[model samples]
Target: MITNEQITAYNEAAISVLNGSAKNAKSRVKVFRVSQLIAQETIMESVDGLHLPESSRETSAMILMNVCCNKVVRPIDGSCCQPPSAPALTQKLAAGFFGLSIAGCLILHLVHRHGHRRSRPCADVEAGEEKKAAPAASACPSEVVLQSCCKLGLIMAYFYLCDRADLFMKENKFYTHSSFFTPIIYILVLGVFYNENTKETKVLNREQTEEWKGWMQLVILIYHISGASTFLPVYMHIRVLVAAYLFQTGYGHFSYFWIKGDFGIHRVCQVLFRLNFLVVVLCIVMDRPYQFYYFVPLVTVWFLVIYITLALWPQITQKKANGSCFWHLGLLMKLASLLVCICFLAYSQGAFEKIFSLWPLSKCFEMNGNVYEWWFRWRLDRYVVFHGMLFAFIYLALQKRQVLSEGKGEPLLPNKMSNVLLFVSVVSFLTYSVWASSCKTKAECNELHPAVSVVQILAFILIRNIPGYARSVYSSFFAWFGKISLELFICQYHIWLAADTRGILVLIPGNPMLNITVSTFIFVCVAHEISRITNDLAQILIPKESAALWKRLACMAGFFSALLLLSSIRGEHRR
Candidate 1:
């Protein structure tokens, strides 16, 4: 055993070296001071040992160096630093804006109430004659304006809370790989609590589609939360799920255009507004790039493609007086042409980048950013939506010929043909599973995904179409989640995952399970509210009976002008 006097001597020597080094270390003075204090504590605790082990001594030295280095390397950039106090003038302007928003909301609410009261006397007189009260008009212009202001203020407040107010702010940590069984457990729990859809429905009906989207979105959420992208199987499955969403997009848009044949500006605006409203709002409030929430842009682009292709072709737009075969041929030709265009873009990465990086969109990127990154991400499953459109055309054609009929309650194929379809589906499922399992890299998987994904998508469609499969096995619970799935996907980037989607924020530190539960609950609730707001806005922006053509055109122009001005102002502020 070492004597106390020797230990004391060793401590004295350590303290002298620490002080001399600290005196010499000018750049890392703070770190040295901290390290010296820690060293003194360690020495006191280890008094029985006259001399530290070689490894322990080395470790202590490393700890000291690291402490000093961390202090010296701490970030000084404005991006990570605590924001400086706002100028008095700027603070006054912010207060004014908040005051105006609140005042506007209250005034609008009062005006509405007054108007309702004024209209009541007339309704009462009519009530005596047994006439029903006229349906209340949609939310008035002032009310809409007030609602818009309130939403803007709420978003700004939320961003403040997340970033500067310290309410939601916390240390951001890189995502760690979670347990393999996490996703499995998530799915099982979701299934256990699933609310089955009991209403009669056709194969791939609205409810069924909703259920598909809901379940896929839920699974994707789980995948993201678990940080399971490092696991190849989970990664591949998530890819397939993303492909399924695009497939639904292709099917939904094509079916709507085919049946309604109304590709008006109003329809286009409504769809785009629904898809992009939340994302655009967040972009302004959070001061992020447009491409930050990319899914909306992807869907918007595809919708344009479908709309333009159908609206431009006379043969495709003609009524069904022409033979069904002719319609099918026209559709096939269009799809083939689309495929050719996609292939050409894929052949030349430069051309693809050039197209997406043009003019207004170029402004979305900060200095020195490469367009190729965006191009690569978009192209990975580029052809999946086209596959969906092709399938939709085939399905519709079969339905027109009465080969597939929900009303008849009959199988689309004879017993022998059904067996063949079933066999094909099983084979396709196995093939995709094997292919996904065997892939070793993202590039390899992306190269093979376009073709492999179709097999599984078709398998799911076929399986769902079996007599009672769609109606009897639907999940109402998943369908509800599906309705707000887009919001969840976009919002999670900032609110659920932090640091530009690279990490998670430590909220209720040291309790991962409770943190996740609380975060997810809050995330889901916010997403639902966002969806409701978007729907309400859509109703206001795209009413059923639109104004005259000239009026509508004028309104569109005015709206775009205002949006451009607002964007320019935001850009200047960011600078």
Candidate 2:
């Protein structure tokens, strides 16, 4: 719809600004004007027919600029000059650090090898037993370097293949016509079924919880890969799964703290180290903020909150086993207080922002200019964790009182009572599903989520464990995956998927099924390796002895201090 007169004005303005930009930066007014003009959809329709012949060099640049900027957002604050791109400077620094870490490892190996070699040589030529230690001495570094290169090469190859090669590029063509069947089909194919001996099958035991995590994680992965977020029902269900995870985080940690009552610096350090280790590495390597992997931070925050809540008062332990109504009342009061605080924070984003934006804490948690993302995330699952804690307390209390019991072949309640509960649980779950599916928009669904998420979660638990056999059996397939579920969740950000999981990594190319299979094998292997590495590191870092623990903590604190200094330097650089 833009006229020829407008086109001419645009061309002239662009040329002048482009020329002037060499000597001095173009003003926002000029850039905005140019961007605004070219963003018209009609311009593309008329692009081929345009007849204004100008200087070849400027004209070609103009044409390219127009093409790149077409349908792009209008400039605001002169940011249009910088087209969208990855966090280049940060990514480069991450890459540099990655290489440096590898180099440092090689150096350490060489030093150690050299020291060992001095004591035991291939050729004591003075002893004349052999002609050469020279080649043997050379073998360790060369062989080690080659081995290191191969490892580095494999990682670099994945980065290049995923990014530059476009073997698995972000594609929305498939998403435009996405279907509910896609995820369902994926679920059916990745069926959750496995068996184990029934000797130790308590309700919500390790295998049961692992199976829950595994299946939930798998569904989430499928939902993402298939771009099923467009479906309100699918999105709602996924949100519930995430809520369930937070619920487990609350339940599991609260149980540990209350029962073990260790409250030692060492236990806290170990848990934090386990949860944050991969996330911290990813933040540096992927040039993402800590809040970018929001789940871990959410879990970490909740864990600390639970720790403080229990650690502060007259400490109650499982060993303190006697029935104390006063202690129970105290626990309930603590939960109520936490709920109030959660509501207060969730009620006002401004208050949430103000509190988190405080200086030292702000440095760690803040993303970009504010904490709105954190606020949004925090508000979404606000009550789930508390619900988890409440559930844990109730279960533990009942168990303490000999009021409820669970075993391998025993139903949660008496037969008739179990049947009634089963019916109620199934009805509740179905009703919730129906409600979730009927919601027309994300806003409508999310508004009800924090309050009602517990319904579906509790309902699922009842349906899962009310029956003796059902409670006893869990899918070992899912449990295996659940063990590495954290790594899988974090790793999918980079290698298993691409574009931060906007698309799948096409390791086999062309054949989607084959690619998925191959990529999955690699992904699972990688997750397992990361799990092993994390456990190995934890063994060294988190010692049982209190004295050893403090030294490790001090070293970790120093490392974080340096990281904070670097971040501050970067912030100043931006200014």
Candidate 3:
């Protein structure tokens, strides 16, 4: 692998070329080619600095990636090209492509149209005029359409693969045979085929300044680990994913470090972080006693510190004034995804309880000190409700400050409609809280927890002012748990199967303390390692485009295998 030091030196060299190359480029292609050349030169310079065993194809592709990124075009006569004036048909098409509801799509269209006008002109005439245009402005509508269509095709192909795998897995579950390995094989095939073409794709190369590099590395590491855990079967993966997500949410508040203030993704992150804080906090408060886990509040403080540090220390938060509308659209998609998550959780909960009594609806209920729990030595529900509220209040205060700032360009208050909706949500939550307080049985309160969860869900939906999506800041584990979250949640129980303790692992072999320590270590390490290997091979061999399909199939296979394995062990023990 090329070293970082080499990359830096090459980048410095490429900068010199970029500074001097503006004089002679005629056609856009030529300019693009020049950029490509600079990128290639930089990569070559870096390659010469390090020894690697990579195939020639890989080296060439990397060089090509540099070339694609470095190219800069002079305008075609009149103005810097703005994506051909977006026709109404194109707007409609964009709406359809994004899977936005008609109303949501219309809202986006209006926002885009309004925002489009305010963008700097592609180019200015030489009558003492200066040109100012964002890089995304230069993108062609045809290119956007092509990419959208390609992504859709990929999704369809993936679903087809999944359906076949699901049917095949019904026969044998351990997944040690070729039929079970089909998806992995398919990914390896596709990765080899498409990895070469990836060089042709011109993904924006955001300048990796030191500050940006540090933050990106940290976030990406968390993302990688969290994603990897999805393939494992550890009970605590969900909780860990949640905690990491909270950390990510906290970090998102400082997005001014790289993106513009109005950047849609930045705003979406703001909303998500808020939502996550509420969920985690409320769960803490309404269910469980304060344990060492209460230190989660310290994250809120850390968030504040980072926000202040970024705002006050400009050196840490540099960004170009103009960036990409693509990023804004991306934000909208992410904001919309919260709805997808809620639906998924609801569906999964229903399916899990229906198929396996172990995951009963009551598993997610509020906890109370009771005789059964005392005898069983297990706490099914641990509430974090108060902590959630505390985090929300802090977030609200920070957001209010942002709104008050003159640089924000718009007032911070939710629109009039949003305010009315907020009022309704507050009323609903209060009424529910009052009703719940009057309840007696632990079962009754436990039953009510899901309902209360719905209220908060609705509130979050209202705040986003978008239907079927979460608007509140949510924990970052959504990204972290993208692949391996399910594995971590389920697989760790087998370690305890030997102890014949209930589904929950208790670490008392001959002695409770030693067993617990050994159990936790074994569980965490085994789960982490398993997830890491599964995800590592998948990451290397499978293109991200096919990851989702493979992940779903792999999970289904893993789940079935676990079920059969456990059943077989039980039978042997009975015999």
Candidate lDDT scores, in order, read 0.69, 0.74, 0.36
State the lDDT at 143 in candidate 3.
Answer: 41
Which candidate should be chosen as best, given TM-score against the real structure? 1
lDDT of 1 at 36: 39
Which of 1 and 2 is ahead in lDDT?
2
- Residue lDDT tens for model 3, 466-567: 211222122232223333332333232234221111222333534644754665455445444444534333333233344554664477458546544543
TM-score for every candidate vs. truth?
0.77, 0.76, 0.24
lDDT of 1 at 4: 62
Worst 10 residues of 2 by lDDT: 74-83
What's the true lDDT of residue 98 in model 3?
39
The Cα RMSD of model 1 versus the native structure comes to 7.3
- Candidate 1 structure quality by residue, lDDT tens digits, 1-575: 66767866887777676666564456332323444354455665464654444555665676665445634554321122233233333334544775688778888789878987776734357456655568988867557756866765675566445543335533434334545466657666775487675465566788788888988888887677656887786688789888888888888898888877887778888898899877766664555666767677778878888888777756374255244666667777888988899889977888887876776666543233567666765677788888888878777767667785464355657767877898889888887788788889977888877777767888988877765444455677788888899998998876777655655644677787788778778778888877877887677666666565447558966865665566566557757
Better model by TM-score: candidate 1 vs candidate 2 = 1
Each prediction's total of clashing residue pairs, residues at least 3 apart in sequence or on different chains, is 0, 0, 47
User: Where does model 1 exceed 4 Å of error?
Assistant: 1-99, 107-141, 163-180, 198-200, 315-322, 364-368, 405-412, 544-575
Candidate 2 to truth, TM:
0.76
